[model samples]
Target: MSPPSQFSSLPKDLEWLILARVPKRLYPILACVSKNLLSLVRSPEIHKTRSSLGKDSVYICFMHKNDDGVGHTSHWFTLRRTKNNPSTEENQLVSVDDLTFPDHAEPMPSIIACGPEIFFISGSYVPSSTVWIFDSRTDEFRRGPSMNVEHSFKCVGLVGSKIYVVGGYRNDKIHQAESFDLKTQTWELTPSPDEERLAFSTANVSLDRKVCGFMYLAAITICYDPRDGSCEVFDLPKDRWWETGVCVMDNVLYVYYARLGLMWYDTELGLWRVVNGLDDMKKVRSVAMGEYYGKMAFLWEDSACVGCAMKEVWCRMIGLVRSEEGGIVGNAEPAQLMGSVPSGYRLQHCLSVSE
Candidate 1:
């Protein structure tokens, strides 16, 4: 006869409750204990329970230049609680060796994380309508529905259940925008913005349920409302031309300006406000920001080194709170050395996936 189940005595609901309370990092070990536990750990019901209880976990994935500097490689790492000191919540970035990205021609594909999945949109010298999705929970890669229009040098934004792909080159013309519906598992064309506005955009983000494409060179931002298919263009502040280090957390857009420190866009005031409490923070040569379980996962490189030498990558978790005065405040921890990479490896992107 088979061994008696470990959770045989507990009720089904009680078993789920107990597992939901456990740290997600421990789920792998729990899965190994029994086949039933393995199935439970990978079930959507368990993830829903954990998410509703506010027990979501964030994992950071980023890309850097390969050691030889010919191409780029992606890596996944998550903040795991220290084993030596279980009492404290001190965590460190441990590489997730099981999760791997497939080889693609694009040096850096536009990537965004929604829940446990990360979508990588295609962008290369040759226009292609391919998309690859990486599932953090299962550590697997699957091809998503391709975009309707082929594009190169594109920008992507995630709003609700849809991912908007905008602004790229196709047949020597600016490709029209398209969106992929996660729920329906299909792609549809979104109304195109001005050809000139679409061509020069370098980055895009979802804000206020709309997709905003940023063109730093022209100091212009095009806002596209997927609901109404309307587009609006506005000029950015003179000093806010550099927007490569931008991310959204809790419906608020945050940008890291090397000369000015961290700032957030005030939707009501239509201006950028300084995120108080980070005044003493030192500026870095390059930085990337992501939402880390309601906090900001900030990563940066101190040196402006070039070529194949090794350099250190630093990280800090900043907690954000709203002030009574209608401003945002940041409580940042001391910087920690996350890992090292080749000097030629620029921190292309940083995204946090919740499981």
Candidate 2:
């Protein structure tokens, strides 16, 4: 007979509470304990319990340049709470996990999250129109169907279960939008935008859990909705088209205007305004923004001199509060140093995911 099991005698409710607190990386070990334990670890209720109890761990996905600065490598690091300083809830990035990404994924990989899975679409330097889907639960990578056309510096959006890819550099003059069905693993061309654009800067979320892909076209910001096939245009206020950083939180689009502080756009009202805080970030470099722990967070590198190429990168979490007069204002906390990267390595992108 098999050795007596420790968790076997525990009540199911107590078992869930205990296993839910375990790190996601150790789920495989727990699954081997017993069939009942494996069921608990894989159950949807276990993750829901962790999320409801504020125990969800946040993972940051990014890529680092190789030694020669000619190649890029992708990785995932968990921002875990420090055990030595357990009093505060501050998070520090740990080492990279065992999860592997597509070989030679571009320095900037276009990605989208659908449920517990993350789809890594083609990047700027990648040639093939292939897509890689990552299952966070299983911690495995699987190749998905390829797109009809190769895209670089394009925008990707997720609506319901399908993924939409917008304008990018392509040889074909059609310049049409293409979407992939997650269930069917098939690609189909969608309605094309009026303008035959060449490139897009960034894609962000816009309203009510919907993905609104944003791209800087000429001097205008094109907000494309994949669900309804609608597009909205917003005029930019600066000439630094390529230097701007954009992210979305609470249904508002936050655009980090180059050297002009952060600006916000309300898609519903079609209004733009300069945010109150974060005016001092004008000198920051390589700024990237994302949503973190129910707040808007940004990661950026400090300005560096010619001889000093490697600079310390910092992350700050900002809270947005609505004024009684209907204006949106931002308040920020102290910036936390996220460690420094070498001269050849660059902080390509930063995204926050809860598990």
Candidate 3:
């Protein structure tokens, strides 16, 4: 027989299902229940929630543009794990590559993944060049396709087997976006929007509650919709992009942007709401948030160095909190959520999102 729970009618499996979507901060609160509930904390099914994690904490790489070309494109730095069990102390930044770049390969990569295993996408900083993939954990490099004939930031979007390389410059007219498929491992030029978009970003919010998929941005801020071959921009005054957040099920595209140190999102209403940060929370940049170990967690770039944007950052831990409304908050530190969560275990979700 199961122990006492607020959800008495819920089957054990159903209970785990609900707890799986709960955030890290809320886990401690939930853990206070009976021992049976506590034991369920370690169950595999709860942690097996993959689609939720992937959608929330989109695995993205840290990228920057060099004013004076000297580094590897911009992602010269790559994050590497220090030791299996990260201590309660903050994860100090570690360099991924042990090799020195040749002069020609000076500008290596501007983008790198925040999580482990999936490594950095090193692209050509110069014109007519091939991009490379470097595994920070193993410190190895594999050459990728030449980025769209020009050296500009590629706003990347990945859905299942395909990777979308959106609007970027190639020294000519600001080129539109293109799509690359991992299955076939090939690039196909998609339809472009009416107007040429530069420095704009593409974010995904799944329309269905389960099984993550893609949706379009139709806010005032002009965004290029490749499917429609139309140049559309969301109103900057309304809302632009959102910061670390979850995926939405509503047919409308809910976009969040990390601008001005706050997590603001433009729902279908076309207004940006300032999701004021928690007392200790800064802008949840880069790293994603989602269920980790039967509880929700927030992941972000741990910038250990000052003044150096190229410095490789590691995934630091944080907990997430949900409210009566669907709103979410993030908080994480060792000895906090799942105080019993083994230090050796690294819980990462697809991207940060609130259930």
Candidate 4:
């Protein structure tokens, strides 16, 4: 009799259980091994199993110009760790060449991650109502239901099952704010603030079950609670805030300031407290921060590559701990060179998606 296949030896349930434990970053490599493994990796059941086991992985996705010198053509890449030296902590960014945004999609679309999917809301000089969803598991893109109103230069926040899009240029005031229901895959208009015109938001995050939109230049923050459809506007703690480096981790709002390093907002105290550690790290001129799994991931350009044709992007993963005195302390790993991009490519967005 012919020998049984290795995959066929185990029960399908048991095989799924084993595969669910594999890190998502290695899924692409696994998919290339065989059709059976590829099917398993792309299967919804495997992802559901991984979610049940709390094995979600964080991936860093960023965009840059394609080397063809075609202006406005952007290429996407995911920063992954190099496996050549598994014992070391070095990591590298690999290009996901197969994946590219729709030609009409904005170069710097407003992006928000929901589970294994990343939603790219359309934006351009003229507002567009297109929404593109990227599935990390299958490495495929699908068109999602468009938003209620055409918006550009918007900020997005994910609260529960719905994604809240706020503060963007739109034709009408009634639909300036809206939410997309992931479960139903429908868009609905939400209440906007009392202001006749909403100021453009630089960054947004979900905290305390509310969507908070920040306007850095104006030093104002608009907090909208979907539960009651009420909006509250407050002044930011700092006169000048870094617009791009704001993220929420463990339900706490963290913002990185050039002068202050990393700081977390204390909602109860209504103040920004400097993280205890990271005093020894050098200052970065620009940074994009995101929540990587349970830790804070900071992406910045390597200052050493001043005149180089390709600039290196460095990433530092920081673990936050609560001290006995009720203060926050950060344990940061030495920065590693994630990879390099063209000198002209700006770090537009850095976000973590769990798969």
What are the models' TM-scores? 0.76, 0.70, 0.50, 0.77
From the highest TM-score down, the ranking of the candidates is: 4, 1, 2, 3
Q: Give the residue spans of candidate 4 off by over 4 A.
A: 1-73, 83-90, 105-107, 167-176, 195-199, 237-240
Whichever of 2 and 3 has more TM-score, that candidate is: 2
> By TM-score, how accurate is candidate 3?
0.50
Instruction: Give the per-residue lDDT digits (tens) of candidate 1, residues 182-290.
Output: 7899998887655446545666788888888788778766777766567777666556545557788767888777777888888887887889989868887567777
Candidate 1 lDDT score relative to the true structure: 0.71
Tell me which of candidates 2 and 4 scores higher on TM-score.
Answer: 4
lDDT of 2 by residue, 23-99 (tens): 55456566777787778776656754564454544455556667686866765655545557533547576655655
Residue range 1-355, candidate 4, lDDT tens digits: 1123687578888877887777565565677777878887766577556545645444554445666855465556665434574223455677777667774536667778787788888865557789899897788999999887787666678887799877565555434578998789899988764542233576678888788878777777777777656777766666457676788876788888887788887877777889998898778756788765446778887645567788878888788888898789998998888777777776656667665
Question: Which has the higher TM-score value, candidate number 1 or candidate number 2?
Answer: 1
**Model 3 misplaced regions, further than 4 Å:** 1-93, 98-125, 136-138, 146-154, 169-171, 199-222, 235-261, 282-316, 332-355
The residue-level lDDT of candidate 3 at 184 comes to: 73
Better of 3 and 4 by TM-score: 4
lDDT of 4: 0.71
TM-score, model 1 to reference: 0.76
Count of clashing pairs, candidate 4: 0
Scored against the true structure, residue 295 in model 2 reaches a CA lDDT of 62
Error of 3 at 233 (Å): 2.2
Candidate 2 CA-lDDT value:
0.64
lDDT of candidates 1 onward, in order: 0.71, 0.64, 0.41, 0.71
Q: Which consecutive 10 residues in model 3 have the weakest lDDT in total?
A: 336-345
Better of 3 and 4 by lDDT: 4
